[model samples]
Target chain A: MKKLFFLIGMTFFFSSCEKEGVLTKGSNPIPTINNTAVLKYSGTFVPTSGITVQGNVNIYAQGNKYQLQIENITITDGPDLKVYLSKSDTPSSFVNLGNFKGNGTSVYDIPAQVDVSEYPYVLIHCQQYNHLFAIAELISKQSN
Target chain B: MKNKLKKALLFSTLFILGYTANAQGCSDAGFCSVGNTFKDAQSEIKNSIEIGGVYGVGEEDVTVFSPYAIYTRIFTNRFAMSAKLTATTANGSFGTISNLGDVFVTGNYKFNTGDYDKSKWSGILGVKIPLTASNDKINNFSLPMPYQSSLGTFDVITGLDLAIKKWEFSTAVQIPLNQNKNSYLSQLAPTDKFDSTNLLERKSDVLFRATYKIKTENQKFIFRPNVLFIYHLGKDSFENVFGQRQTIQNSEGLTINGNLITSYRLSEKNYIEASIATPFVVREVRPDGLTRAFTIGLSYKRNF
Candidate 1:
């Protein structure tokens, strides 16, 4: 009986160990730009203090709706990364676009309720750890 | 013998606590086991205490361990009351979380049938109260419902059970009193493939179960095979980031499960039971996070 109990205990101990998920590079191809689409804001990605990042970010006005696009991007891989449109360089008071599709061109649909003028910074952030990887300060292409 | 029983009870409790396992996919929302649903009908005990543990794997390979205790008091031959407390711990790629799950208080009233040996009928009423807020978070990001310990709603449960010789049939309904404050949006973690449970308003669930019992010649062992069906009355809804209520498509449907229970009498006042359940059919979307691939449990019951 003791040996049986020991075996059961060992089986549970081994089975209870959590399996870690492997993070793989993901891709989201850029969408085709229509004639109705107009460039509203553009920015270039800048790495945070110790992070490496390079990309061009653009916000396009398609009729009343808006779309944010990241092109030719490369960044340090991390867990639970998210794309956010923030009012400031920091992630506080932000509209989450979605999870970051690693190292590629991706387009995210901005909610109609979100006003681009109010959120001037596009941020790449690790949502799980609350760490900022890169920031892009949006410059108004219409104003230029 | 008394000392041996005490030691056995202590050992079982310790084993359950240390197992770190998971629980059922009945999708009951707290009504299926309300009042004498799975109790032994022939036992003459007026009161009893039960300790049990269940283990299962849910969506996204999330492992869940649920340990529960139940206390019952029979006021008369016709009336009885029971209270159950459950605690849950979930571990997965997201993280590990532990919390008190829910509490259920239920009453059962057996009605006199013309012939007691031929048939018996009982009415059940119960209430479920959430112990956790159902909004547990990790690093400010809200964990999905799979990680939540409770469904986070006050619910009213009503049911009826009828027993005829070796066959029993029961039907029950659970209605949530209010929406939960959970703010987990799966879109924020798209790779996880979890559904949004943000400010979720769940629909009511109706359950029906049929069981057949078989007893050994010596009456020392009993076996029960049960079939359970649950249907969501309507589509559940959740709040979007834009503060709009959106219905989770295909969230309203039916789930059918097959369960087998075996019980052994250790003595006049002691019994041990083991059960296993697997789904035969499942809904397309289980945003509530009660989707279990399978479940197995063991319990010890002491009667007085």
Candidate 2:
């Protein structure tokens, strides 16, 4: 019984234990994530819809140095609003604000920073969801 | 008042930037596989829907639109089989070649020599069953080719795929292996002079293809543009329309083609691919460039 116990211990030591965290094990011992959600929006391009909320925006940018800036504030006819962060967003530790547009206009098309280092948290709730449509992301500018 | 304004602007800026930088988060309904097997299968399915054909343009202009679908099932790290179905329309203004269609099923086996950071080699085998009929239009009448066109003339295809890091290399060949058809000769003759046995000898062909790929998203997405060179081997076992001894070298020469493909994974079960092939000469077997043609097509897929 002692010999069998020792052999069993060795068996478990060498198997597929090395690739534990990376590759999935068992019949389907896959990794699980808790805070992921689906997002979908459609617009016909009505001048950034006035609000201009964007996610998955692919633009060209550098570190958190604030290399580029866009001000889309067309203060048209909308209510006064405020922006806040939610903690559930993963992948990014924290989010940063670039700047506001249309200091005093009929509509508001706020411009945000293109750097990913600072704007990590991607959750933004708005009392105004219809006006904001697209999110701009800074892509690499090396190639055309 | 100063602090309130700064904070308000700060929050607004973060909110906008954060939303714009949103990646295809894991929470979406679709799934994109990260492993090698999944990536390969993803490329194949996406490839099936591409809309470009080599033999589409006639000697002077594009005659028809060519479309095809490919399906592949991966069984192991190095083994899989694929089925391709295709259809090509007729270019009437040019010559006589009419609508063409085919259905092919083949198996593939790959060998992995590289490890977590190495290269691998893959081989593929498949048979073509020409499901589409072969017809040549004469005025209002449809004149069928003497031999059955599609599956009846089973064509076997084979190829090898090699990959080192993000760069991949592959080559494939196809050979027809079915009985020869001789009805066309019979049509030319009244009866006694028609020899059914002496119809088609040069049906066998060999196609060579190569590809260059740019892998991204840690190899999850790949952009591989490829080129194909095809040569119809041997010679027509039969004779020319004039019943004279003539070498149809022009019709039986080699062909060249190319395509650029973009493939992405939405989720494990869902993936999308797109591609375009430039104008290529089809039916080099024709005596004149007037008979040359090209093809293009695309497909969509969901893993069950």
Q: Model 2: how large is the Cα RMSD against the reference?
A: 31.6
lDDT of 2 by residue, B1-304 (tens): 9999999999956643443232111100000000123345543343222222323333322244444444557665556655554544433322233334566666667676456358777676666675532322222122223212232356666667677776666566666675433223333222322222222444555555566778795655668776656565655444333223334344455655555667776666555666545424444343211222222333334564
Worst 10 residues of 1 chain B by lDDT: B15-24
> What C-alpha lDDT values do all the predictions have?
0.77, 0.38
Which runs in model 1 stand beyond 4 Å of their true positions?
A1-114, A118-144, B1-29, B41-44, B113-116
Question: Quality of candidate 1's docking, in CAPRI categories?
Answer: incorrect
Cα lDDT tens digits, model 1, B236-255, are: 99976644689999999898
DockQ of every candidate structure: 0.06, 0.00
Residue B218 lDDT in candidate 2: 68
* DockQ of predicted model 1: 0.06
Compare the candidates by DockQ and give the number of the best one.
Answer: 1
lDDT of 2 at B36: 24
